[model samples]
Every structure is written in structure tokens, then in C-alpha cells.
Target: MLVTGASRGVGRAVAAAFAARGDRVAIHHRDSAGLAASLRASLPGQGHAVVRADLADADAVAAMVDEAAAALGGLDVLVNNAGQAYPHPITEVSYREWQELWARTLAVNLTGPANVTWCAVRHMLARPPGSPPARVINVGSRGAYRGEPGQPAYGAAKAGLHAMGQSLAVALAPHGISVASVAPGYVQEDETNASYKVPRGPDHAAQSPFHRVARPEEIAAAILWLADPAAEWASGTVLDLNGASHLR
Candidate 1:
């Protein structure tokens, strides 16, 4: 199994959950070597690996996937949880910043995952006959449908990611690959944290009738379920883990 952006936040939780399940996970991080190393060491099971790659770089994404497949003895699951965001409110940012952020955000959040999934699918296809079906779960956001006025690029990228997951679910079904995505809302990096500790904490909490935002582990658990073999029927679906914050 490979979980990108596993060094922190929701990605971190996902990696931990999988590792605890006795699966050898390849933890991917862009520049968080220290955090990634610590996470790999903290995982309960053995045979876990640490992989680094800047998702924006196509070559790096390819190499990283290959390394993970080799180290883990082939990929049974792939979690695309890496993302980049720049709060460039169109009215507040310069045109140059707008263009740069748009490009960077889309590259990391959309195109990069597509490339990584493609590489992983290739490795998955090589598995011996009669093997269990492979799973590819994408970590998307409720902002894709609710909108991110402060970061339009991020919203657009996530929307594209969801669409891509659906497309791949259809395309890969014949090959025994199931694809799905989770759209989470206002997830705190830590599961135990009760507050955002920022000015908008109350506002974010109020978004959900539950009076709180999502915990990383909550999102991780949904991801874990989607990766289960029984979840094959969920392919092409985007499960909402947003606590009803943004109903669609």
C-alpha cells in the first residue's frame, strides 16, 4: 500500500490506520523527511517504507511509485492524499500570483495524482493471477462542491480529482481495480483537537449541525472502508465525510 502526503494531517492518519491493519505501507512525503521517518518508525507493523517525491514533478511521481511498489512487493492500494493550496483570493492577489498559484495547485492536486495512479495501476496489473482486486482511494474535499472563494484553484482541482476518480473507476473495473474518493470538510490535522484555535474556529464548527469540524481519523476511517475489497460496488462514487456541512 502507498499513501501520499502521509507525513501529516489526514494523510498521516490514513498511513497509521493501514499500518495498524498489518499492511506494509509506503509513506510518501515531499519535503517532510523528518516527519516521514518518524511516522515510518512509529507504525505498529514491520516492512513499512518511506518514499519522497514532489508530486508536481511527473518524473518524481513515477519514480516514487516504482520505489514504493518494489519496497512493498507490489501495490494493493493507493491513497492520493497530497494537495497544495494558496489562499489567493482573486480580488486580493496580483495577476502573476494568480497564474502561478493556479498552476501549482492544479499540478499537485489533480495532475500529480493522475500520474501516480497511472503508474500504480501498471504495477497492480502485473500481480499474479487470482489476486485480490486493487483499490485506489483519492482524498478530495467538500470545497469542490461548496466552493473555496479564498482559493478557487484548490476547489477546481478537487472537482477535477473527483471526476478523474469516477472516470478511472469505470476504466479500471475490467482490470480488477476499484477507484473511489472521499470529500471531507474542515478536517483538523489532529483527531483529538477540539478546536481550530483560530478566529474562524466557531464559524467552521457552525458549518456542521454537529457543531464541530471533522477529525483526521474520521476521514481516515472512511478511506479505510473504501479500500476494503467489499467496497468494489462503491467504485465511481465520491463518499462525503463532511458531517453534513455542505449538503449536495
Candidate 2:
């Protein structure tokens, strides 16, 4: 299994979840060498490998996937969790910033994973069908549907990823591969900690059906479940882990 952005946040949790299940993991990080080292040491298995590459670079992405596959002996799962967001109102956003935002976000959130999936699917198709099929679990955002006012690029990229995952699920089904997207809402990470401090009046807790923001582990469990072999027949599924927050 290859987990991009494994240094922190939801990616870190997902990596730990897979490790707990005895899966050999390839932890991909971008400049978080210290955090990556700590996570690699924390994993239960000895085969866990740490990979570093700029996901926005196509060559680097392809090379990273190839190297990770070699290190893991074969590719079984891919969790595309690396992402970037620039929250700025359209009026204040510059042309250069907009281009940079879209380029970086789409590269990591969409194209990088698509390239990795292409490589994984090719590898899976070459092997005999009886073995466990390769799984690609894309980490998306509820912002894709709810629409973050200031982060248009992030929302658009993630929306594209959701569509891509749905289409790939059907396209890869015949080859015994499964693809799914997990769209999470208000994940309680450092990035969202400030938002939590703001009071939403009396009905704030009741706004979301779940009554609170999601813990990273909760989202990790969803990813793990979707990647399970038992979900082999489940394809083109977008498991919205939003707790019905968007309903209101």
C-alpha cells in the first residue's frame, strides 16, 4: 500500500490504520522528513518504506510509484491524500495565484493519483486474477459539493477527483480492481481548529447530524473499509463521510 502525504493529518491516520491491519506501507512525504521518520518507526511491520517526491511533478510521481511498487514487491493499494488549498476571495486572488492554486491542487489532488492508478492497474492486470485486486481510495473533500466560498480551485479539483474515481471504478472493475472516493467534512485537524473556536449559536451542534466535526481516525476507518477485499463488488461508490452536515 502507498499512502501519499503520510506525514500528518488524515493521511497519517490512514497509514496507521493500514499498518495496524498488518499491511506493508509505503509512506510518501513532501519535506516532512522528521515526521515521516517517526511514522515509519511507529508502524508495526518491518517492510514499511518512506518515499519522498513532489506529487505535482509528473515524472516524479511516476518514478515514486514505480519505486514504491518495487519496494513493496507489488502494488496492492493507493491512497491519494496529498493536497493543497489556497483560501482567498476571487476579488483578492491574483491571476498568478489562481494559476498556481489550480496547478498545484489539480496535480496532487487529481493528476498525480490518476497517474498512480494507471500504473497500479497496469501492474494488477499483468498478474493472475485470483489474487486480491488493487484498490485505489481517493481522499476528497465535502467542499467539493458544498462549495467553499474562497477556495474555488480546491473544490473544483476535488470535484474532478470524485468524478474520476466513479468512472475508474467501472472501467477497472473487469480487471478486478476497485476504486472509490471518500469525501470528508470538517475534519478536525489543525487547519480546521480555528473554525471550531467560532460559536454557531445554540443549534451549532445540531447543524450536523453527527453533532461534531470528524476525527481523522473516523475518516481513516472509512478508507480502510472501502479498501477491504469484502468491498470487491463495490465500485463507483462515493462514500460521503460528511455526517449529513450539508443537508441543512
Candidate 3:
């Protein structure tokens, strides 16, 4: 299994869960070498590898995927959990800044995953005869449906990601590769993401009836379920993990 952005936060949790399941994990991070290495060392299993690549760079993404596949022997699952969100409200930023934010956010949150999936599927297609269908699980955001007023690009990219997963799900079914995505809302921030998070307060918790935000582990659990062999029938489905915060 390979989990992008596995250095921390939800990605870290996903990687840990898979590792605990006795799977060898490839942890991918853009620049967080220290964190990625730490995660690889702390994981429960051996053979875990740490890989780095700038997702926005297509060549780098291909190389990274190949490296991971070689290191882990092969890839049975891919978790596209890497993403970026920049708060650039239309009214608050200059036109140049707006363009910059859109390009950067889309590159990392949408195009990057698309490229990564392309590379991974190549590996999946080569699996031995009778192997179980491979799984591709993308970590999307509820903002795709609920709206990201302060970060329109992030919302748009996530919406695109969801659509892409559905399209690939259908396209890859015949090849025995399942593609699905999870859309989560307001997950509790970890140390690595504290600066980008909304301050924890009653107002923040009130976003859901549960009066709280999601834990990384909770999101990981859903992702784990989606990657199960039994979930092959669930390809193209976008599972919502928002705790009833935003119904569509």
C-alpha cells in the first residue's frame, strides 16, 4: 500500500492503520523527510519505505510511484491523501494572488492525484493472474459540496477529484481496480496542521450535531473499509464522513 502525504494528519493515520494490518506501506511526502522517515520507523511492520516527490511535478510523481512500487514489491492499494488549501477569498486577494492560489491548489489537490493514480494503475494492471482487485481511495473534502467560501479553489479541486474518482472507477472496473473517495468535514487538526485550522471552539464544534469534529482515526477507519476486497462493489461511490454536518 502507498499513502501520499503520509507524513502527518489524516494521511499518517491511514498509513498507520494499514501497517497495523500487516501491510507494507510506502509513505510519500513532498518535503517532510523527517516526518516521513519517523513514520516509516514507527510503523508496526518492516519493509515500509519513505518516498518524497513534489506532486505538482508529473515526472517526479511517476518516479516516486515507481520507486514505491519497487520498494514495497508491488502496490495493492493507493491512498491519494495529499492536498492543499489556501484561504484566498475573492474580495481579500489581488488578481495575481487569486490566479496563483488557483493554480497551486489545483495542481496539488487535483492534478497531482490524477497523475499519481495513472502511475499506480500501471502497476496494478501488472499484478499476477487471479489477484484481487486493487483499490484506490482518495481523501476528498466535504467542502466540495458544502462550499469553501474562503477557499474557492480548494472546493473546486475537491469536487473535480470526486468526479475523477467516479470516472476512473468505471473505467478501471474491467481491469479489476476499484476507485472510490471519502469526503470528510472539519476533522480535528493535528500539530502539523494547526496553523491552517479554524480555532477550536463551540462554534466550530457546532458545525455538526455531534458537537465535535472528526478524528483522523475515524476518517482512517472509513478509508480502510473502502479498501477492503469486499468493497469492490463500492467503486465510484463517494462515502461521506461528516457526521451529519452537511447533507447533500
User: Whose TM-score is greatest here?
Assistant: 3
lDDT of 3 by residue, 106-172 (tens): 9999999999999999999998988766999999999999999999999999999999999999999
TM-score per prediction, in order, is: 0.96, 0.90, 0.97
User: 1 or 2: which has the higher lDDT?
Assistant: 1
Clashing pairs in 2: none
Q: Which of the two, 1 or 3, has more lDDT?
A: 3
lDDT of 2 by residue, 1-248 (tens): 99998888788899999999999999998788888888899899789999988877878877888888889888888898888776766888889887877777778778877887786676667665566768989999888988978878789888999999999988888777899998887666644224423433436446587687778899999999989999876678878887788742
Compared with the true structure, all predictions reach lDDT values of 0.91, 0.82, 0.93
Whole-model alpha-carbon lDDT for candidate 2 = 0.82
Candidate 1, 1-248: lDDT as tens digits:
99999988888999999988888999999988988998998999789999999999999999999999999899989999999778999999999999999999999999999999999999999999887789999999999999999999999999999999999999999999999999998876453223322333788999999999888889999999999889899999999998888898
Any residue pairs clashing in model 1, and if so which? none
User: Model 1, stretches more than 4 Å misplaced?
Assistant: 191-200
Q: What's the lDDT for candidate 3? A: 0.93
- Choose 2 or 3, whichever is better by lDDT: 3
> What's the true lDDT of residue 182 in model 1?
96
Q: How close is candidate 1 to the true structure, as a TM-score?
A: 0.96
